[model samples]
Target: MITRHLTDISSKGFKVHEISGAVDTLHNHNRRDYYKIVLVTGDMILTYGDQTIEINGTILFFANPRVPHTVVHRSKEKKGYACLFTEAFIAGRERAEILQSSPLFRTDANPVIPVNSEQAAFLGSLYREMLSVHRSDYDYRNQLLRSCVELIIHEALKIQPSPNGLQQKNAATRITHLFMELLERQFPVESTGDPLRLRTAQDFAGALSVHVNYLNRAVKGFTGKPTSVHIAERIAAEAKALLQHSNWSIADIAYGLGFEYPTYFNNYFKRVTGATPKSFRKRKV
Candidate 1:
């Protein structure tokens, strides 16, 4: 299997690379154990979760471990810098990795930010400086790198679109948010040997310590969709991504997606998308 697990790449806690010609070799980016930030200028399409984002100019892109993303590079001129860091690399003196709550990396927030020439120049300069400082013999290089990461976040915030006025969330809304988080945490199906653990609304309710009925009501009330629909939709999305991007066989993909049999998986796929796995993969190819 082609997987980019954090254990294999977190030896130094972080790495910075100059991106050019094409994107990273790996397409399964849901490493769920580290974070990624990239700044690039290009014309391409970014498949982020169930949404597709178009890229034309310089943009600062923030990617978390929670979601799976694929980039279809369309411009050979695309060149910039990418920084990959483990939580241990950025852990604060007194706090854990608080990026889990950062608006820039949130799953629902915009991960792509278009930058003007001036902003891109400054961010690109930081990446270059980080490259130099990271490979130097300076004793405090790590500290400097962490500070640069912070500066990038602060800079992105300056251009981040302001959210609506804050209002206190009701209990239902809070519960619904928790459900969504829990749901998203078990995604990207990295391994065919490891199937999904939570596949039903009842399972989610058990994990949340709430009655299944209550969970269903809260989710439907907040999102106007049933809990089961959300779970299936996410699963179907991952299935499509795996079929399109991985070389795994259909049976392995079915097993990875928690199907008891290939027939079951085919039926589910057809029901959700009106296409069999074979046809879907063929079309994607």
Candidate 2:
């Protein structure tokens, strides 16, 4: 398959590599003790598990250490910066809260936030400061790293989503927030081989330790869609992404997605996409 490449550096429990130029390769980088926060200018495609988001002039977060992903530069020339830090670099529990409470730990949204001119300046300054400490022979590198990250989060919180979009969130909306967290955690994994990985409400209910009927009721009440439909939609979305972007064949895609047979996958893809996987991939090509 034509996958992006990943460059991993985890020596000293954490490391950072600054990147520039078009994203061409498909690969992954893994670190046992670190998470990655990327601030980029220009444009690129980021594939995190099953979701691939188009990003430009944005700050994005990747929280899970187990999931494999890659960033591909779409242009002949691209520029960006990335920092990988271990939890140890964060030091105190308060710093950990910054990551957990923020949308960085959540996977539901595409999670790409645009940077305003002012925010961009702030981020650039923070990154420069962090780089300075990283390169310097200073004795307080850890303290400087922690402080720079704090500044980064402060700047990120200043960003406001578009007014015309999702309403402003409040703590009063607790159930929905919890529901979104649960949904995001499960949505990307719904497909086992690809024909619809999560085929039943009970499957999710079991995972969440709730009654199947209650799960169905909550999902339907909140989203106006039944649990099964939501699961199907998520699987279909992932199917389309694999078809469009990867070089895997239709049968291989079906198997990768969890379909038992190519025929079943073809039928399901046609049902949702109004085109077979082959046709859809061809069109994208």
On lDDT, the leading prediction is 1
Candidate 2 per-residue lDDT, tens place, 62-167, comes to 4445344676765565555667766555647767666554444432323456787777677777777777777788998877777777776655655735433343
Q: Per-residue CA lDDT of candidate 1, range 83-193, in tens?
A: 888767886744323353353345555678899999999999999999999779999998898888887887887877776533213446656876798788878789978
Give me candidate 1's TM-score against the actual structure. Answer: 0.59
* Model 2 Cα RMSD, 1 decimal: 11.9
User: In model 2, which range of ten residues has the least summed lDDT?
Assistant: 1-10
Where model 2 places Cα greater than 4 Å from the true spot, the runs are: 1-9, 29-33, 58-63, 108-110, 160-285
Residues forming the 10-long window of minimal summed lDDT in candidate 1:
1-10
